[model samples]
Target chain A: MTSTTVTSDVPALVFVDDLAEGFGAPARPFHGASPFHRADPASTPIDVLDLGITRGDGVFETAGVNHGHPQAIDAHLARMARSAALLDLPAPRIEVWRRAVQEAIEAWGSDGHGAAKLIYTRGIEGTGVPTGWVYVWAEEPEGPIERRDGITVVLLDRGYRSDVAKTSPWLLQGAKTLSYALNQATLREAQRRGADDAVYTSTDGFLLEGPHASLILRFGDEFITPGTDQGILKGTTQGDAFDWLEGQGYGVGARQVRVEEFAAADAAWLVSSVRCAVPITRVDDREMAIDRQVTDGLNAFLLERDC
Target chain B: MTSTTVTSDVPALVFVDDLAEGFGAPARPFHGASPFHRADPASTPIDVLDLGITRGDGVFETAGVNHGHPQAIDAHLARMARSAALLDLPAPRIEVWRRAVQEAIEAWGSDGHGAAKLIYTRGIEGTGVPTGWVYVWAEEPEGPIERRDGITVVLLDRGYRSDVAKTSPWLLQGAKTLSYALNQATLREAQRRGADDAVYTSTDGFLLEGPHASLILRFGDEFITPGTDQGILKGTTQGDAFDWLEGQGYGVGARQVRVEEFAAADAAWLVSSVRCAVPITRVDDREMAIDRQVTDGLNAFLLERDC
Candidate 1:
């Protein structure tokens, strides 16, 4: 069953063929073949033995799609490769995945804002093969409202020290993996604490990233995000935002952020792919002033990102 | 795509209908109907949006099967419920799952040792309904050999304190969730280090469990496993083994173990469902003597378990 015509906001799924046919692997037997093809969303292409679901043994990237272009496509793909390497999975064929993303976006008939979630997994157990898929769908309309109204966030303990990725690489920190049960639990915890979102603080009192977004704080005129050395994912959206902030004559950098520094910050926002840049109006019991001008500009820049 | 016949050692899949129909939920429209049914292993059934695959937002239990009987099923199911509660997933219907396991085992035509893995997920994204499946398959023929000959292990840092479960419940430390990329990575790391398996130690230097198994160290005549307070899963296999040990008039208990005490122990074993109890011949660079009599007796009892 195939449906090329984009209808409602339902997700369009595409499966990648030979997801990790890198250097040592032989070329596909069939020549002139596309690396990916759209599959029926209703069908379950995933096997019961697929480690992707069975073990959550996979890496994924959700890139914001503006019109027909995937935002930070290179960065997202690079991060995916890095995550795969961290998990010791095979290196993903970037060009093939890049083409797959574009094909998925085009097949979804992207006319406005959407998200393309690229998934690469260790595939079926004992197969020595990998699985890849790109699912594209229209973004929810509430993103704009969330950006405008702002969100409340709470600082929660991440239960790991800042140097965890360096000390324990098997812990799989800094990797956007399918093993996100803890991340989802963290989000639910934030909601349970009467907050819309949460910023993770390391066990030793260092500020980290959010469950699904990167934390960016503005102190005076300087913008800063937690350094990537602290076992946090390299934020693609925050990187792009920093570039825009620099262009606007604002000092932007990355460094180790203390948990207590949240009070001294002029403003804060959680930046990521689908949600873009969302201003944090409240941090725990503290209600901070929101920079409406900067927030608006950042959102505009993020939503319209072509690269 | 229906196959009721068990052809080879391939897996037999069964889907549970209304997986989480516990209290405060609607009953099945048809009464006196089976809560689960056999599924075609070759057919695609899982949706791409399943949180099980996307976020690894789910709980699972693997019970060893012998002569069509699921070993430690009750314990496995109970642990699954505990894992679900830890992740805030809906409470699973135990009776339905028990029946599903039986049906799956029957469908698989289990004649010897096998494994029945039960997976209950938070379901497709945005869908309140949960997803569940029972997969039964024949076990590899190497467990007896490994149990008799033994395996080597390396100690890896778990990157968390022993009391993490109580301090940060959102970490989902003790839960048997599908987010096992780290567990898989730990195994790979051990393999890379020229070891057969990996045992985890807390950041504060407390001996923990293995990536997929429980650690049991024999000191003199007393056997000790890591206390459950250390953010580790309560080992169902170890629990049963303890019962057998008690029958043999041996002291078995759980407590906080120090990593440095490994050298002082008489023997150690990494025990799990599928692998049963495999003696640890070496830890890191230290070679330990294997208890062949206890190992063989334990495997025999475990393989012949009726419950």
Candidate 2:
């Protein structure tokens, strides 16, 4: 009954007051005030009838915070905007969100690495107003500093064809919504099968992405990720890594990749905002080789990158 | 923002203390007290990091509360347990939940009608303790007394094959988890297409249920709903209606219904706990006949059902 033990790492929270006022929407009457204000995460600022939780009608982004810098936040914000559009909730005020994230990070005052999560919801039911918040908490990375080695993953069927996004946009396939129960279920399924993570595949035998990350496979010098057209998220971390990879003269592309190509790949990694580039050592029953040099490079670039 | 206008229907909430203690789980150390306690929904009892909102890692059921009676609550609880098992959450204490619902309804003090929504979440992230709450408020039945006419529906591709539940359990298809953003999106798409609601169809041409309701088709004296094997929630209202229909000498069944069969059916109704049985007047551009007699009978049974 008492929550003394569960009260560890309370996040610094900020509620965005002008979340849905973007995209030529009329400004609020009180225009001089700050767009967002910090709130207590433990105080539970959200309404019980908020569509975000009740109907899972919301989108979110989590960016890694290094020292005072929120890493790859612009891309995260852009993706959040895309997700919001996909859900048809409202246009997110990118400037407001950026300031909210900074405020939350500043409130947290963590010089170490942590995760800054931005949550934008469709707001309370029957009310058109949207709710938005950003919470930052310090994340003490367990074990080694770099997360770039030996992650075994199982390929699970996502139960949709690769072209589901194109055929059925209402399915919200490409949108990074808060409705991630199935994604969590996939990871649990992976754990049950004695694997560390899961890589989702289309029913038609095409590699998609991980439950919460983007999958990038290496075929000789060419690095290919399952295209965003395949109803998967456009990974922010993956994008940053691709930029670094391109600069290093490695071919990078996002296209329809077959599951059979996993076996042909020299190495693979599941990339995400918080976790960065985690090397895939095993896929299903097959043992995949780890490209340690490239993995190290990607992780280093991701950890040190300012933007 | 001072939330004054949006604070009209504050539901009476009861938090179940012994939520996940069912299925042979050991009782908590403090056992000599009430299993649940009333809380203010406006206070936001949920943790910001609760998986229910964060990952949509939860299951919920909303039963129609007619006066003091919670309609088909046992069925809803059973379904919630099934959903929790599917999501690997600990089993819910049904008796405790029943009492919590009763407490919430009693606290609401509404004699007319309302919705009693039971929410069982996986609790705050990394905390094993599950969170359970039931909220009840006066529904005040908007407009007419009966909700059994003039509903137009559009058939949208659910983007999964009919046998997805059998082939891919990790998809969490049949389980009524809290991840309903896509379902909300589907409804939006239906509205955009000038329809009131949507009925999902399998990629392989099988009839699935609606986003938030069960589709029941009537062909003369026979009533048929999609089988549970199609990865859809088994409708509690539909089941009660089936029992009532059987007693009325009508044939009722749950089977693998095809999309083509919808056209052949004489009448169709989308049934849910809160809405009862609403007759579908149209499917896409095609107009369908509404069986007023049968619809009225079903609604009467659903609205007046005890226990």
Candidate 3:
């Protein structure tokens, strides 16, 4: 497949066929009509549309690129596996996934200018198994931000359906499924209420993560995030960063973070594979300054790991 | 369209080419891509699908039939309109829906069936409006139940997505979108726990309603149901029963019902378009006797209506 760039005011629409062609590789096969089946089958080849992403039934993961290679590839794969299992979905073959990422990066050439996303989903049709429609996409890099200038966030009381199980319920929290209509709605609501990004809180007032991202706070020199048991996904980037932080003699831990505690953190940021770590300047209407120690420590950690 | 009835060992399957052909009169039509549309567009045309009852995305009204004719036809039409409005869908043309129902019943001959269903939904594909698929299917003699023995109900903590709105959120609640996968899952889970049906409670512990049905209770000769404020679709059957009961001098009211209140009720049953009132024998693990008041009141109500 050929790749072309369109210079329109609208966001680039990357065709799915081209994406699959660039990322597709031979993988282990399984047979079942359900989207949750672990094995690929000889039935109709699946595409992105077939995966409930259009309907928002699947989950996804992305990672920082180092020298045009995804960092902590195994961690992302393992997380995807866990998410798939939780949703009773068939897991994609790791080797196939690796090859797809490699090809996707190769398609982007040696620029090392963008992040890579690995999206896995229940293929088209409600058969309940993973279709072999996995692919990677390259996007413009997020600009570096002043760590001292934290980002602002909004707290929305719109409880997520998967808020009870942290990550066990495959319906929402586990995989980056396509059931994102509500997430988008929440974001729109947050925007309407004047906020940069929204942190979803359950009806009981427990702070979840930001939409399409994870939350991290720096207390003293320690890096802290809400535990996965607190109804949030076990973020791959957060996990890697925590391990690296602890190894460097910095305090890093996971614990339950109440909504009030998050609102009053010393320093906070939203973490994701694409944006790495973006500091939070304000939450709802409350504001905070970025922690220099935390930012420097995380940047040094990312650079040292070549992420 | 031809009408055919196939009696399987399990349940009877009735097929109709046109829903309008069955409902005696065509209901009013609305405009737009979904049945939830508020405006009527000149470009839109009414359409119907054969997979009406199977998928359950269509709006239906079950009213007592007198001499094979429905009562309070306007109320059902108005509810269907509200359902269509919520889904941003179009309603069927009133004349078309009326004619369809009339033709179907005449075809059925002298079947002294009391219950009639007016099903309106996005019909078969390729009709105008691309999304404006609408149809009606009528059924006589709703499902049979052994009311002498109460039915078992399983309590599910899984929250309903739209609980704050009085009308069904058509995109999510009303207008009968074809997303019944969760409903099926809930039923399977209930059956797995050895229950006849399931009652979905809100995340806040308020009793919502049953899957594909409404809640009714007999509390000291007063018929009580959850108010629309509790986030249930204004049930037509429940509304009719309430009006009829109040007119008959029985204290009937709609109010918010807590989960504990539902559990503690002396007698309860679920009312819907198809199932008039099925007694609840067990809730979760707690069992209750089938209160004679519910049966007596319901039978008297039905008999007084000349059903």
> Top DockQ: which candidate number?
2
RMSD in angstroms between candidate 1 and the native structure over all alpha carbons: 3.5
Estimate, for each residue in A1-307, the C-alpha lDDT of model 1 and write its tens digit: 1111111224677777757855212323332366566776765566777889999999999999987999999999999999999998888999888998888888888588889999988877876777788989887655667788889999999889999999889899999999999999999999999999999999989999999999999998999999999999999999999999999999999999999999999999999998888999999999988899999999989888789
- All models: lDDT? 0.86, 0.85, 0.53
**Which of the two candidates, 2 or 3, achieves a greater lDDT against the reference?**
2
Best by lDDT: 1
Interface RMSD for each of the candidates:
6.9, 3.8, 16.0
**TM-score, each model?**
0.95, 0.95, 0.59
Off by over 4 Å in 2: A1-8, A22-32, A141-146, B1-8, B22-32, B142-146
Which CAPRI quality tier does the interface of model 1 achieve? medium
Better of 1 and 3 by TM-score: 1
Reference contacts reproduced by model 1? 0.65
TM-score for candidate 3, residues paired by index:
0.59
Give the runs in model 1 whose Cα sits over 4 Å from its true position: A1-10, A22-32, A141-144, B1-9, B22-32, B141-144
Candidate 2, position A303, lDDT = 80
Judged by whole-model lDDT over C-alpha atoms, candidate 1 comes out at 0.86
